[model samples]
Target: MRTVESRNWYEKSFGEDYLLVYKHRNQHEADRFVQRVIEWLELPSGSRILDLCCGAGRHALGLANAGYRVTGVDLSSVLLQKAKEADSSGCVRWVEADMRALPQDGTLTNSFDAVVNLFTSFGYFETDREQLDVLKQIWMALKPGGRFVLDVLNAGYVQDHLVPFSQRKENGVVISESRVIQNGFVIKEIKVEEGGSRPRFYTERVKLYSPQDMENMLKETGFLLDVMSGSYDGEAYDERRSPRMIMLGHRNL
Candidate 1:
C-alpha cells in the first residue's frame, strides 16, 4: 500500500501559477514601498539588506536600485528564475532557501544590516513554535543594532472584511477564490481555468496573529519594537481599522 505524502501548501502553490496570479504586483509599487522602508530603517545608504521570502525579487530589486546591497531569498525556484531574468543589472543576489532555515549556514550569520519580510510572508508554519522559529532565524541573521521590517495582513481587518467568495478574469483566465477562517488560519481555495483547458486548484493557508501577538513575539526574540504602522504610508497602526500591520523592530545595540 502506498502512503500519501504530506506536504505544505506553500511548497506547491508558489510556482508559475503564483507569478501569473500576482503579476500585477508591479515594480513601481515595490519601489515606492521600499522607499518607505528605507526611510523607516534610517540606515546609511549601501547598507546590507535581506529580503526574506523575496518572491520574484520585486522588493529586493527595488532595494538594490535604491542603492542598498540586497540578497533575496525564497523557496520558489521558479520565482527566483523570474527574478534573475528581471535583474538585468545583477544588483541583487537571489537565493533559494526556506524561511524556517534561513541562510542554512553560518556564512551569513549576523551579516545583514536590515531584513525585510514583506507581503504577509510570515505565519506559514503549522505550529506557533515553528512560526516563532522563523523570527528567531531572522534575529540570528541580524547584526547588533540591525533592523527588521515585517508586513502582514491585519488580522482584525481581515476578519472584518473577508469575502467568502470572489471571482475575476485575468489574461483570459478565470480565477475564483473561496476563503474561510478555520482554526485561527485564513484558508483560501483558488481555482483557475483557462479556455479549453483543465482547471487548476491551489490552496493558501496563513495563520492570523494580532498586532500585539507580533510585538510580543518580536520582543521575546530580542527585538525592540519601534514602529507599528497601519499601512505603507507610515500611518499609526489601529487594531480596528488598519489594513496592514507593518512592524519595525530593532536589535538591541
Candidate 2:
C-alpha cells in the first residue's frame, strides 16, 4: 500500500517553480502599488502595516523603503527565503504563516494600522465559511478604524476575457498554461520545461467571487467597505470591463 498525501494545490504549487513563473512581478510595480495604497490609506509615516500573503516581499519591501513598519506573512517558505534575500536592508519582518491563522502568539490582534492583500491572493479556501474566516482574521488583526486593501481579479471581466491557453519562454524555460472556469472557480494548469529536464506540472485554482460577494463578506466580517476600484490606478470598478477589482475597507469601530 502506498501512502497518499493530501494537501491543497496552493501548498504544493507555491514552491520554487512559482518564483520562476512569477518573476516578472518586479519591484517597480510593487512600488507603484504601494504608493497608491499609501495615498489611499492616508496613514502616518511610521504606521505598522501587514502585507498578508506577501509573496516574495515585493510590496512589503517597497512599503518599508517608503518608511512604514512592515511585516510580511506568507505560507511559502521558499518564497519567504527569496524575500529575505531581496530585503538586504533588514527593514521588513517576514513570517511564514497561513492567512487562515495569523494569530502570531496573540501579538497580531489589533496590531496593524493597515493591511494589504494584493495580487488576487484571496478566495483559495475550499468552503465559503473558510473564506469568511480569513476575512475575520484580517479584521481581528487590525486596530479599530484601521484600513485594508484587497486586490483581486474582477470575476465578471475574467469570465468574459479569460484566455484558455498561453505560452511563454523566460530565462531558458518554456512555460505553458491552460485555464478553465468551473464551479465558481478559475482553474489553471501549468507546464514548465527547462532544457533536458523532465517537465513539471502544477495547478492553480481560485474561487471567482463577484464584487458584490466581496462587499457582503467584508460587511459580514466587520469591515466597512469604503471604495472599490478597477485597477491600481484607482479607476472606478466596472463589472463588465475592469481587469482587477481593488477594494478598500476599514475595521468598523
Which ten residues in a row are the worst by lDDT in model 1? Answer: 1-10
The residue-level lDDT of candidate 1 at 34 comes to: 91
| lDDT score at residue 169, model 2, on the 0-100 scale | 95
lDDT of 2 at 104: 63
Give the lDDT of residue 230 in candidate 1: 97
For residues 66-131, what per-residue lDDT tens digits would candidate 2 score against the true structure? 899999999999899999999998999898999998856977889999999999899888899989
Error of 2 at 58 (Å): 0.3
lDDT of 1 at 142: 89
- The residue-level lDDT of candidate 1 at 63 comes to 90
lDDT of 1 by residue, 141-223 (tens): 88999999999989999999999999888898998999999999999988889999888878899999987798888888889
RMSD of 2: 2.0
TM-score of each: 0.96, 0.96
